[model samples]
Target: MPPPQPRTHKAKPPSPEPRPSSSILLISPENKILLLHRVKTSSSFASAHVFPGGNLSSQDGPIPAPSSPERHVDSPVYRLGAIRECFEESGILLARHRDGGGMLEVPDAERERARRAIHSGEEKFSEWVKKMGGVVDADALLPFTRWITPTSVPRRFTTQMYVYFWPLSGAGQDAKIPIGGDAMIPTPTSDGGLEHTAAVFQSCATWLEQARRNEIIMFPPQFYLMWLLGKFFEEGKGGAMELRVQREKVKEFLKGSGANGVPWADKVMSPVPLGMFEGRAVLNLDHPGPELKGSGRRGESGHVVQVRFSKEGPRDVEVRDAVEMKRLMGEAKGKL
Candidate 1:
């Protein structure tokens, strides 16, 4: 028999394949975007603020055409899922007439009932849309980008981001307007205490400011999108211009994915900032920045670069390892 080898360290296990999910970026007429604060008890995003979205259900049907192009064949279901999840998570409904007439003006009572039923999973999304006599507002939404969770996570998601801008003109169409009518505006409310506990709307600049103070626990995708939005706003790119560019980019990605008839995902992947253990998913980044002492590009574990937010500056220093991670987790009763 061979001699026993000394056990020094254990390598992390590989994560499972990422599952597809969809989310919607609900842009208001005032350019203020909505964000939902996940419930602290939530299994996935726990206490982090995120956009209104969720996993796709079997009820999401085929891609509605004329609004969706043929090249985006694989994306319509995602779009449908996005719209459906947006309505369920946020009170705002994005559906409109198939003939591009106007959005359904759901009354306060009806809205409350629909929201409750949806949150409790007592009513199906397809049935609710049917009750309102409308299909998913596939035409109004523009596919924007994709975000994939880091490989360090045991479970992962490849989220599809879709953006829908509130109409600048009247609510109903006069027969000459483009795809659909103006979306009906509603105050967002969070009823799913299981997923989200609260909701708020803020400008991109304000959001970036909060990120600097570490008031919001944002992942790389959220952090990166906020950075991009701030830059775009600074460059004087109006809401319409930004959405147009995003729509064009989505088309490019879709068409490019069809080259070899194999579906390819256009995902913006970012490295994990904190040290992970045994392929565990990151729960939160509480007060993450270089402002803290010893917070830099390296730690006891590996490279620990901080994603810069506005306000505080960066510091250049030698790389260090995160030897205390295991110790800290141990002190905290195995909680990371």
Candidate 2:
């Protein structure tokens, strides 16, 4: 054999720096919360459930404020991004009147102008709020939670979660209302862009039940929030009025000791847990439809065939082959 060649070491590739993400959470005046169902066509996390929020933009930076808000402004970028996303995704503007009444009302014309400004890229949120006689009510937004996507994930966000309550009106209820609306009256809609396909109202109990039963697909933040909400409901004597009080307590709770217990930490384990699978099944079956195979079918298609094992017994047979005749017959009769 020839003399062994000298070993050569290969240089390791450089590790990529982490990217940050941000988001906002809005609860309507009706006590119904808002969430987004990501479109199946999305390039990132397609078909996954999410909130009405997004990553921070370059324009998301400090605005001159006469007084410092409750949140940190050193990175006003994150706050600004959160406010912008709240508007973009949920039609809830975390802004106040120039006089400081903490109310949001814009006429049709003004609403249109603001929308135009945002669309044209000429309107910065801070400047627009100031010009339109409004202030960024970052104080009203409660910093509920924060999350950093795991490094293993292809896409990530250093998301800051905020919760805010907004007034509801007929115009606000209009799902087609444009963001910022026209000057006559602010028309807030649930059409929160492609990132959100549907927005609906449900109580914390309802949300938890759905999540627990796997009726809805939610990410960590959403899942955690729902679990926390469930605890609040549980603590509230299981009544709507008590639940409302518990809802208000959330802001204080977040600022103090954080949620009583993080459900994700306590509940989520093993990538493929029974809870997650059950949730998936529930979400899949949410709509009106036939039950799954093992659940039993209804109607004329419910017939079952019985097979007898003879003395020749115990021969292995493929179910697919056995079902082929039945399948073909069903197809021929248009019963499949």
Best model per lDDT: 1
Model 2 superposed RMSD (Cα): 16.2
> Native-vs-model 1 lDDT?
0.57
- Candidate 1 Cα outliers beyond 4 Å, as residue runs: 1-14, 61-74, 172-184, 234-305, 308-336
Q: Could you tell me the TM-score of candidate 2?
A: 0.60
- Weakest lDDT window of 10 consecutive positions for candidate 2: 281-290
Instruction: After the best TM-score superposition of candidate 1, give how far the Cα of residue 16 lies from its true spot, in angstroms.
Output: 2.2
Q: What lDDT score goes with residue 113 in model 2?
A: 57
lDDT string for model 1 (237-290, tens) is 446556556545534543443212322233233344454343332322222122
Model 2 lDDT per residue over 237-308, tens place: 534455457666765555554222332111111111111111121111011111111322111111111222
Model 1 CA lDDT for position 306: 43
Worst 10 residues of 1 by lDDT: 312-321
lDDT of model 1 at residue 141?
Answer: 68
